[model samples]
Target: MRLPLGLAAYRALSWRAAQPAQEPSAPRPEGALLWLHATSAERLAALADLGQRLCAQRQGVNLLLTVNAAVAPTEPAALHTASGRVGPVLALTSDHPGLIRDFLNHWRPDICLWTGGDLMPNLICMAAEQGTEMILADVNAASLPRRRGGWLSDVTGPCLMRFDAILTDTAETATHLRRLGLPGRRIAAMGRLSTGASPPPCPDTALNAATQLLAARPLWLAALLDHDEIAPVLAAHRDALRFQHRLLLVAVPADADDTANLIATARDNGLRSADWHGGDPIGEETQILICDDSGDLGLWYRMAPLTFIGGSLRPTARGNTPYEATALGSALLYGPHVADHAAAYARLAEAGAARCVRDTASLAAAVIQLSAPDHAAAMALAGWETVTESAALTDHLIEMIQDRLDQREAAAHARA
Candidate 1:
């Protein structure tokens, strides 16, 4: 009485093919196409960063992200997905030949970037046969299959050589790849690709209004403060207020539960405060602005030139990302407990983009010194450069992809 599932699926496929090649939500069909495949969603996050960079630079480039269907929902929430923005995600469990052909024909990616382990042999061979340019990145020795020296020994060797570029994690992986039949010249050991956070959009009118209201006020922000960090932050503000009487402190807590304690502390220390959530006005006499709203970080980061990222004054509380503030032209001040983002903090420190303070005395001293316009301007420039450091690898990948595309175009033209 009912049709079989396979038969219905085939009919649906036929209907889709008959309608059109392009989906309305997808990018235009005439431009360059990039295909990205990741062994896991974690790896996909890094590849998605690369895709975002490529789309930002190239005028008409389309990206298609592919991942295993099993791990899509459970992927870590901290990582950036860029789903549906750059392109749609294609979930491939097992590569059926007919389905693979349909997907390739529909998207027709000009360049392909695959990350992590577990290469699909059929997909690689078919894509190679169709002359698609491919790159393999973030691979390691563990990614290779075992059980060699048999009738089917090294069966996927030729397929592995299809990639134009291969970047592995360690020198051992590079050695393993060369032994696996991929040319030594095409493979190298490089560090993992970097991931960057997208800049949150801030409305220009709102930014202008805030800037006008806070005109000529020497201000700094204490962002995402924890309960343990309140005393040190308030003490630092108290010390800094001595030299600059007109100085303002924009205090925002990581948890709203600490809000009442913070306001009580500010008033107890003889500082006039304005509670943003309680409809209090920031009059000329207000020394501390308590922003109880957690969602308006974009506003504070832009309003203040120097931001002290909270939750790092104590050893137990690790810090948040420094790029979010640096990306908005804010110079950073943080304590030493930055184990969560050690690489980013180290880079910013080395570049002279940020300063490290141990206690309230040191924090107050650094705040007073950085309040000078010339010093803050130079530090802000360094911080901006540090946040955009991913552009180096991005440019490198773009050059390689473009060169391969040019070569393929020339070869096709010669044949014609």
Candidate 2:
């Protein structure tokens, strides 16, 4: 495929190849390989989530994540799932012809999901020449890449023509793409893609056993607890206990090794505590269940109707995302320090599915109020709805990728 004049000029002037990646990846494995490129940091998480969903559903799908960012992250590493290393996460700094050639020749992905549309003419044109099934996702006027050669006759339009499909973030973006001469059939408005993950698995046996043992006690979990949060959390639990004596607080330390210290802290605060690993029954008198790891945090989310995300309460920025808890039907209580996951928490708060607790007093109050079975159930419903808001788009992507893989497999067999 001959490059357009703009791309030709870009190729001519593009002498500086991409830097040698710091990490060495294993040779590409056999089977369908999906390459997802994020044009910036904000778009990376959604692609990463898509990778995780694919891995969970289809056992052997290979994923490679690349980023074309203004700056490389301080550290770049492999994108790992529970099974193991999915693939290398590369930061593609330059799009010189040589760099693009080496990348396409070496990786030779079965399909490409080019996200946020910082269109790399060299990369896209070369990959299309190789007959790679390319899809540009979440394209908007705001996200389109503008380069030096953009002033010349048409890099973006001709370059985008290489894609098999273009998914825009809004109908307005679809119109924008049409203005650039892309056929309507190739473009669709799929609102902002989600970083939706499959809910953490909870074995039926474990869930049933925990349910029977607890016997429907009012339960809440303080997940990913930091060292500094120990006193305040236990105190909150103690205070909430006055109103709801049957309340159970499941405290999981951020570090498994801190289990002993948390237990000691509970004892010092005159609260009854039992280690989950200690083989002690969670009787009515057991005020706190000290869990060592958040590994089984899924089970706790199922057992408890409400959860307080940890890092938020500590003297730091936001806690971990509450999506996991929401996915598993748990309402959320969090602190004001939620910079990391501000958007997610903000959504939940607006929906009344989550509360932002300012201190020990507020945390205790929220636990006591939200623990009502009806109230918690309502919030959990809202949370679950919020998490699944982007389900239709997610399902479509999964199905599309699956169909792409199936086509590759069938084509290979036909050739054989």
TM-score of candidate 1 against the unseen true structure = 0.60
Query: What C-alpha lDDT values do all the predictions have?
Result: 0.75, 0.80
Clashing pairs in 2: none
Q: Can you write out model 2's per-residue Cα lDDT over 1-416, one digit (the tens) per residue?
A: 67678777777777654544434445887778899887644456667777878889998788888877452553232122211434457778667777677778888899999887677888888899988999988787776755565422477778889989888888988987787678889999987665554678888998888888886677899999888888898999999999999898999988888888898989998899988878877788999999896888989988889999988876665468788998889999988876666667887888778988988999999898987889999999998887776677667787888998988899999999
Leading candidate by lDDT: 2
The TM-scores, one per candidate, come to 0.60, 0.82
| lDDT score for residue 38 of model 2 | 76
lDDT of 1 by residue, 1-416 (tens): 23235333533454465332333334437867778887765466557777777677667677788876454544433223347455567666555555667667777778888877677665665676677888887776666665456211243455566788888778887887777666899998875555555666688887887788887798999999889888889989999999888899999999988899899999888889998768788888999999876677898888888999987889887677787888888889999987656666777889898999988999999999988877877888999986675555556777787676667669778999
The whole-model C-alpha lDDT of candidate 2 against the native structure comes to: 0.80
Candidate 2's C-alpha runs over 4 A off are: 1-5, 15-26, 40-43, 52-61, 74-85, 145-153, 213-216, 242-246, 274-286, 293-295, 315-321, 335-358, 372-378
